[model samples]
Every structure is written in structure tokens, then in C-alpha cells.
Target: MRYFGGLVHAIGSFARDRSGNFAVLFGMVASVLALGVGFAVNVSQLYNAKSSLQGVVDAAVTSTARDLTTGVIKEADANKSVQAFLDANSRAGILSADQIVLDKLTVDRTANTVQADVHVDLGLYFPIFSVGDMKRVAASTTAVYSDKTIEVAMMLDVTGSMAANWWAKTDKIGDLRTAASGAVEDLLDNNLDPKNPRVRVAIVPYAEAVNTGGLASTVFVEARYGSNVPPPIDAPVSVSLTLAPDKCATERKDKDGYADYSPDGPNTPRLDNDGKTYLAKVNRDDHMKTCPKPELIPLTADKQKLLDTITDFRADGVTAGGIAAQWGYYMLSPSWRSAIADAALGAGPANFDKKKVAKVAILMTDGQFNTAFAGGRGAPRSQNAGQKSRSNAEGICSNMKRDGIEIFTIGFDLDDPSMTMTERDQAKSVLKNCSTADTSSLKHYYEAATGTELAAAFDEITENIEKLAIQR
Candidate 1:
């Protein structure tokens, strides 16, 4: 009887023991931690899937929009384009490739917009505590593609400065040609239709003077001369000199005594005080030496012709950026449509609607605008032409911008190694002033320090132009 009573007391004491409480509490805490960790891991995976899906959607919509803007793909094909892009990029890491679904694609031709919605079923890495094994993640993206027609006027500087051999193991002018041509190809590739392309390009190669070549007679008035002996009517004699007819052109002056920067049709050709037409004359020494004689090629979609003209360019002449800028503006001006047509350059657009057409000028120069000469065949060079040239260039830029023409200025190796810092700063300042204000996150000014850099700058400009072309 006593043994039985002792066994009951021991059982009672064992049931009241507090020494084993820590083990039970630790077990409960561990269970809760495991569930929390599993839920967190699954949530992280879902977040990652969402991010990946969003990226795919964004890329697909952007590419489709670009192709649509360039007319590479029709609205009916937008869904195909997006699906193809997604298929090419889809992987089996965060999101299953086969689970990706293009929920909807909407294309508004009139609005020039492309929108896409995509959904993906993502399998959870750790489905714990009654959570589901899979979740549906979705993403939507929209892109607005501009349908505006693009007209580009490339005003290149073929001055003597471009011939400098300072660029390490590379010719500056050659680099420029390659870069400019590459830009042309990029802007027009897959973006043109033979019947009605959305893009057209013009080239204005300028030096101390702009050579009109075969188009000179059509644009300039008859040449006249002034002699030492006074004529019967107290006027200079009308003399015909034996010279190349397609050699040069006189600068157009504004009626307000400022540089004639307005693209208001052809200016009345200047005349000497003797009522004789003034002829454009180059320095006798630089006539054939430094003058780039390529006539300006007006707006055209002929890629081969444009490339050929750029390749055939030879660096010769003084930097006349103002004249080049003016010519660039003229190429896009509605007023000069008749002149362009008469010269057979190309049929100019009937009208310029800022909403439907984008007029852009790419002005590139390697040196300061420091040369200006009088109109006569052998007129003396101006003493203070550098300042005047800069002033004239700024005036032209202002006028062009006022007309809604976008200007992009490039200073290629403008900092002469042998020149002073002040001079280099001045050159850069001139180019900066000539460039239009930055708009839509696109900068209008660039400076290249080397030939490779110059080429890269042109390529960057080309990209910006392309983006601008497809995005309003």
C-alpha cells in the first residue's frame, strides 16, 4: 500500500515540473519562423516575376511603336511584332516562357500610339502555410509614336581646318564623312517607302563661299564689273571675265542691314554701286586649293546619292558657318520650294506644318568662322570678319529657330592644340550660341575632341534625330 502511494506522489511532482518549459517554447517559435521565412521567399519571387514581366512588356511595346512609326510594320502587324519580341526575350528563370500571354494589343493609327498588356503565370518557389503554388502577374505598357515627316539639312564644314593631321592616326575629315554617312544610313534605314518616304535629307557643304555649281545661274543675277575709268553714265563698266561659271555665289544681305538669315525666298541679288550685278569671288590662292566645290544637294530620299556626295566631299575652303546655316535653313523653307524645284534638286513640300513636319539642321564646324571677303572677283578680305561671321551665324540661328526649325550644332576639334584657351572657349561659345535650346531631353550642342569622338557625336545626334522623328 505504501509503494503505491509513493508512485502517485512522483507522478504529481513530474506533472508540475517547470524545468522543461524552454524546449516547448522554442519549438513553437521555430514553427512560426519557418512559416514567415517561406512566405517572404515566395513574396520576393513574385516581386521578381512582376519586374521581369514589366520589362518585357515595355520593350515589346517600344520596339513595336518604333517599327510602326517608321512604317516598317502596319497596325495589323503590331501584335505580331510584340509577340515576336517577347518570344525572343522570354526565358525560364523567373517567369515561364510558355506561360507568357499577350492579353491585348491596341494600335491607334490616327493617334500614333501603341499599347500592350501582358500576363504571365509565375510558379512560387515556396508555397507554405496554405498559400497557392502559382500566382498571375501582369504588366501593361504604352508608347506614342510620332507620324511627323522629318526633313534634315546637314550643314558640314569643309574648311582648311578640317585638313589638320592632329588627330592621332586618323584623318578628321575622313572620320566626319564616315560618321555623317553612317548617321544618314541610320536615319533612313527601314524608314523610307519608295513612293512616299517619311524622311528627306539635304547637304550643304560650305567654305569661304557656297558653290552653287550648275545651279548658280538659276539662283544668282548676272555678274558685273567696276573699272578704274568712269563710264559715260558715271557708273562702273560692265565687263565679262573669263571664269568658271559654276564657281561661287555672293552672300545674301538682309534688308534691315543684318545678315539675310530669313528663308523668305531668294534675296534680290546684290549689285555694285554702278548698277552692275556682283559676282561671288574666292581668294585667288584658295580658288582650287581649299574650296569644296560640291553643289548643295537639296532634300531627297536617294540614299545612294546622298552617300556618294558625302564620300566625294574634299576638305577645302575657309569656315563660313553662317552661310552654311543660311543655306541649311533655305533647304527646309517653303519659300525656297520654287528654287529647289527649278534647280531640280527635289520637289519641295507644298507646306510646312509644325505638327506634321519636323525641320532640322545639323551644323558642324571644326574651326571659328573667321573668313569673309567682298563680292567682286578679287575683292580684299575683310579685316574684322571673324566677329562679323559669328554675329551673322547667331542671327541666322535665331531666325531659323523662330521659324520652328530645330538646330543641332557640333564643334569637331574646335579646340586647336596650338591656340590659347581663350580662343578655344570662344569657338565653343559660338557653336553653343548657334545651337537651339535643349528640348524634349535632347541636347542641341556637342563638342568632339578627336576623330573617333567626332564620329561618335554624329552617331549620337543621329539617334536623337531618330527618336525625335518617331516621338512628338
Candidate 2:
């Protein structure tokens, strides 16, 4: 009976020995629950921060990129801009402290764009179960930059008619000077490089003729003299001092309607002295700060000299502008520039036609060329292009002006002297069409009878040029 009582006590003691199993089971279940809650809460917060950071970076980079294209901001400025943007967003609580960092930033000036990579770090927020502080990282960003120069040319008319109020306005010549001076100042103000020799100018002065009359005339005449006068339809031939290998003297008409003959030297009718006024340079303080060397030789061929020549002009002669137009074309033609480079007659040939540099020409006149007056008596130009000295000055200006040269034309004071607008419009049309682009690149034609309108015409032309420089 006693042994049976001992067995019952042992069974009761065994049932109470479950302490180790309960502890193990409770620990496992607690660990699993904490892990699931921590993952769900912390991971979701990290993901939300990452998305917000990406949105902020996208906005910042895009804003900076646009500024680069206008030449306002540079590639070097891009990084600073991006950093500033990020800082602003962070201050707004769009980002966490010390959580944002620049992963990488690259600036490429050659391509004009800046590229940036950004990183964001997230910290654990919920502490329901303090397993550990978690780190969540996300990457985002990009920004871009741009810089470009415009091409420009100044086409000016230095024709004689521009000097006198030949068209009835305040001296067309004065108007031209006013307009061109204004243009240069505007260009300088707008950042054009006169020294860079990039922005160039070509002055074309047309009259009854283009007095290659100075040193050029001296040389050309000595080499070129005609015996059998070209027909009245052709450009009148210009001769030096007339003295045929077998003839007597060279006779020229004076403004007073008298003919004097010269056989050479100071004795006969020297082509050097005309009965009317002579060509002289007048570079007053008003001119564009007299250009440098080779370009400042108006004692022969300058804006002033050309203007003076225009002033000295006589109405006795008919216009044979084609020859003058041809010469102007030659001035801006690559082939001509190359050929004349060695001729080196008027100005410094260097700046005139540097390799790869652009060429330009301006043709201005008031007449349609009905006659060509050779310096001699009755040896008039034939207004005829086929047989004469190529009476097609308009055609010459047209053909060559189209290639690469920028051309402009001004028809002053004539009310359809050619009997129709077609003749006048032809050259002007060619000029306008051959301008650099479409609008600012073409030529301008102005008609002025009163001084105010003529001056206004000049102002209008200059304004167009200024507009081109600014736009370009």
C-alpha cells in the first residue's frame, strides 16, 4: 500500500516539469511577429522617401537644363544650381537631414550639358520593436547646359549721289553716313568684334562710273587704252593720258563744255585734272574711327573720297552702272578677291579677303545707265552689254552676289528713270534675295524726294542691320 502511494507522487512531479519547453516556444513566436511588423513599417517608409526624392531631383535638374540653352548659365554653374535646389527642397522637409548626398556630378562643356547622380538615405522611423536602426538608400537626378555666335555683315553704299541731295533729301550721302555710323555703334554695343575681323563690311559706290581714277586709274590707264571707240551701246572706255603709239594727244571735255587735248606731262589735257571738282578724302571725326592701316587710303578710295567724287559728279553723262557693279562684285568674289589680292590697288588687301572669311557687297546708284561716257570726246559707253565693256553691271552684281557674298542695294532719287520699275527692281531684288538668310539677309531699296524721307530711309536700313546683329 505504501509503494502505491510513492508511484502517484512521482506521476504528479513529472507533470509539473514543463518549464523549458514553454520558454523556447514563446521566444520563437515573439521573434517571428517582431520581424514581420518591422519589415512592413520600415520598408514602406523607405520606399515613400525614395519616391519623393526622385520627384524633387527631377524638378531641379530640368530647371537648370533650360537656363543653359540661353547662354545665361554655364556648365560650371550647373552643379551649384543642382546643389542649391536640393538644399531648398530639404529645407522644406522634402528630404531628411544628412540623408541626401551627391552620388556623382559630371560637367561636359563640349556638349554643353551637365549630368548629376544623387543618392538619398532613409532612417528607421517606427520603434515598436527595437530590433535595430535600418538604412534605406535610393538614387535619383540630371541637369543640362548650352552656348552659340551669330553671323553678320554690313553692306554700305558710299556712292556719290548719297553725298548730294541728288534724290532731293538731305544729302543722300549724309544720310548714308548717319545710318552706317549708327550701325557700327549698335554692333559694338551688341558684342561684335571689329578686331576679330569676323564681322566685315563692303562699301559699293556707283556713279556714271567707278573712278578707279586714282592710283588705280594711273596703273590701269597706263596698261589699258582703246583706239577704235566701243559702240554707244557698250560701256565707254576710260583711257589714261591719250597718246597713241602713232597718234597726237588725248582730249578730254571740261565742265565748261570745252575740249582740251594733252600729249603727256603737264602740257596737254592731263586726265589728272578735270575742269570740275576733284576726288578727295573727307574722313571727318564723324566717320567710323578711321579703320586701321591698309583700309585708310581714301586719298584714293575711301568713303569720303568716294562721296567727294560723287559730289564732283556732272549730269552730262549717262549711267553705265554695270561696270561699277561688276567691280563691286569683284570686290567680294572669292575668285576676284584672290586675283586682286596680288593687284593690291585700293585698300589693304589682307582684311579684304582672308581665307575662309565671308564676303559682302553693296551696290547703290540713282540711274539706269542709258549712256557710257568715256573720258574722251564722243567716246561714250554704249549702254549696250553685248558689244561694250559688258554693260551688264546689273547682271554682274546679280550672278556673283548670289554665291556666298551678302549683297545690298539702294536705289535713290529716281522715279523709274529706266522707264519701268523692272530695271531698278532687278538689282534690288537680287540683293534682297541674296541676303544671308531670308529677311535680315537681303538688300533694301529706298526712294526719297524730301530730306526727311531720305533720312528716314537711311534710318530704316540701319535699323534692319542692327536688328540682324541683335537677332543673330
lDDT of 1 by residue, 273-306 (tens): 5565433221121222244667778888889988
Query: What digit string (tens of lDDT, one per residue) describes model 2 on residues 18-136?
Result: 69766787799998888788778877877777777787677777767755543345566777877877777863334665556767767666554566678765558764555456564
- RMSD (CA, Å), candidate 2 to true, equals 16.2
Best by lDDT: 1
- Model 1's TM-score against the true structure: 0.77
CA shift at 428, candidate 2, in angstroms?
6.9
Best candidate according to TM-score: 1
- Cand. 2 TM to true fold: 0.41
Candidate 1: count the clashes: 2
